[model samples]
Target: MMAKKYSNKINKIRSFALALIFVGFIIMYAGIFFRGNPIVMLIFIILGMLSLVFSMVVYFWIGLLSTRAVVVNCPNCDKPTKILGRVDMCMHCREPLTLDPELEGKEFDEDYNKKSRQTKQT
Candidate 1:
């Protein structure tokens, strides 16, 4: 069996933002190659700018989520970390942590937080 991997939600979003920034730069750089085609270059530049702007929005969302996330000391690492929902992994140790006692000792499942699941469970 392959070991499953999980990452802290905040960290995941951060990395996604970072990747977007890189993609934006790459798109803009590709535009330079089409310098002879003004229309093509403009399209590339616009697309690049959009990607950058979207990344900023994602970063802002992460900030808001951080405020709502529950902070707790990871039992495995003894380090302060945040959990975004009912089930989230420790930022430092990747230990599966849960805020709900009913979920304790259960396997981590992201679907546990969905509205559909909540309705179905009841």
Candidate 2:
């Protein structure tokens, strides 16, 4: 079986926020089709606005997480990358990296970041 592709956590969250924006805009556009029904149009508009506002909140959260992420130089690509959890991938090369020596050379698993596993790593 082929190994699963992993992406930098920050990039994943960032992309999700972007997707939310697109979805919100699409929802608002759909509201135009219901212009004859003011109540239905209003509902769609409000829901779309909520989606947009939530996306902004997610963006702000990622910004805060960025400040706390650990920065390290990727051994494979020799480029700097940020690690948000116990296990993460290099943003440039997608090399699996771990902060725990015990996990080094092991198969890359995102579950290593879970609170239950964090205690084991420590």
Candidate 3:
């Protein structure tokens, strides 16, 4: 099987936020073409603004998560990166990393983090 590409959670979310901004702008521009219908244009503009607001919220959330993320140097890439959960990818090299020693040298699996969280609640 081919190797699955994994992304750094923070970087992924940041990309999403960037995409949202572009989408919001596109939506707002679409509103301009609907100038004939004042109500439609108003709705589109409001929706666009809402999208931008949501993006800001997501960005803020990433900031909060960043405060909790663990910073470590990647063994494979020899670069600094942040690990958000028990398992996360290296931001610089996309190398799979784990905070748990037991998981070291094991295949990468996102479910490891989810399982850890579930066990904590039980």
What's the number of clashes in each of the models?
Answer: 0, 0, 0
Q: What are the runs in model 3 whose C-alpha is more than 4 Å off? A: 1-3, 116-122
How high is the CA lDDT of each candidate model?
0.91, 0.93, 0.91
Q: Candidate 2 overall Cα lDDT vs. reference? A: 0.93
Better of 2 and 3 by lDDT: 2
Task: Please provide TM-scores, in order, for all candidate models, with all chains considered together.
Answer: 0.93, 0.92, 0.90
Worst 10 residues of 2 by lDDT: 113-122
Model 3: which residue pairs collide?
none
Backbone clash pairs for candidate 1 read none
lDDT for each residue of candidate 3 in 1-122, tens digit (9 for 90 to 100): 99777899999999999999999999999999999999999999999999999999999999999989999999998999999888999998899999888778888888877966548645
lDDT of 3 at 98: 90
lDDT at 6 for candidate 1?
A: 78
User: Relative to the unseen true structure, what is the C-alpha lDDT of residue 83 in candidate 1, on a scale of 0 to 100?
Assistant: 92
Best by lDDT: 2
Runs of candidate 1 with Cα error greater than 4 angstroms are 1-3
Residue 17 deviation, candidate 3, in Å? Answer: 0.9
